[model samples]
Target: MEKEEIIYGAHSVIEALKSEKSIEKIILNKGQRNEFYEEITQLAKEQQVKVSFVPQVKFRKYENLNHQEIIAFTSPVKFADFETIIESILSKKESVLFLVLDGVTDVRNLGSIIRTAECTGVDAIILPKNNSAGVNKDTVKTSAGAIFKIPICKVDHVHDALFYFQSSGIQLIAATEKTDNYIYNQEVNAKVALVMGDENKGISNATLKQVDAKVKLPLLGSIESLNVSVACGAMLYEIVRRKTQ
Candidate 1:
């Protein structure tokens, strides 16, 4: 497996703590002083990973070290298979909430969106194998440790995943600016899959046609569009809010 780049921020390091992959080692600035240090030490102990503190300059060479003053090196990023994700979610027997990214290439956007999705009770996050950002240390950092808690599935073809979800009784709701139905007004009953498209293109015409419902966020600002992740948060919470109500 190809190794992903290392991440050195607190949130990214914490998410790495929760991942199943073995953390070969962790590095910290010598005599690191912070409330989060206790948690990091505890987590490292729990995972049986070795931790050591080096000079602050050493950590500064690789990590942001704004607060935690810690960095970690772990195994390569693992991408889950589509079937495995489907089977796992089905076995859980919970209401399905999937967040799909169509050509979202920004790592921070993907990470922030995943964080929001996890908070909103999304079951899985789906991305196309190509043209989509995969799990990286920066992504984990941006997600604030939420990346470890959520299932991220990368597929050869996004349309195949959508087709599979639809066959598995999940409804596809595409979040786009070019839609008449606002997300707040939509019915997200049954298993729901919410798709957020690229920042530049929005959803492709072909993909939009495959969606069961095309919903837009109510924009009351001078700005024409919201960031994809922010828009996704809005749509996802709406689903959670409507379902539980």
Candidate 2:
């Protein structure tokens, strides 16, 4: 992370939150409640920014800096507005191809997925602002500069985004190991949004219930599942193949 990307101190953090800055996460000193605690918590809740409570000793790492018990990490990339982007896509009368991620916290996995999504001609990538990984220096490096080419939207919740896509006439397809249906059997040529989940847990039950179709890649090896990035590539290429043929 860059130095300019970090904002600390109580008043400064609160102002940033109020101004609707793209905050990746906020770290608060554990067991230290101040006058601004309630206000900060409420603002974070409203903005859907993840907060982590850590020991005071963690603040010692910042020499010659007064953190005031709170620090907010700002995202390196500016997030595009989902509604605006969707409206533009629809105005153009183009088939919608979105990559929606649920609870995917791994930075590298997120970067890899973005890289593949761009190459596969996905319209945009959407993720929840609180639980998902934010684009940063490491993500940019891992993506090999693909992060700049693709538009990323960080919303408050993935379920809400799924509903928005469905209302706009896009089908939702989820990739999970729990599914008996294979990816090859699905029809991907129409307006569709492909949903990928976390590394350990597959799609959350709430989000799974909203999907129009759930498909899985066959696992013939001893391993039961593939890495999220590899699985994402497999699914995306399958969509491309179906569209062409």
Per lDDT, the best of the predicted structures is: 2
* Candidate 2 residue spans exceeding 4 A from truth: 1-4
Which TM-score value belongs to model 2?
0.93
Task: Name the TM-score of candidate 1.
Answer: 0.70
Instruction: Compose the digit string of candidate 2's lDDT tens values, residues 148-217.
Output: 8888888878888999999999989999877799999987756889999999997999999999999999
Alpha-carbon RMSD to native, per candidate:
11.2, 2.0
- Position 233, candidate 1: lDDT: 84
TM-score of each candidate structure, all chains considered together = 0.70, 0.93
> In model 2, what are the clashing residue pairs, if there are any?
none
Candidate achieving the largest TM-score: 2
The 10-residue segment of model 2 with minimum total lDDT is 1-10
Q: What is the C-alpha lDDT of each candidate?
A: 0.79, 0.87
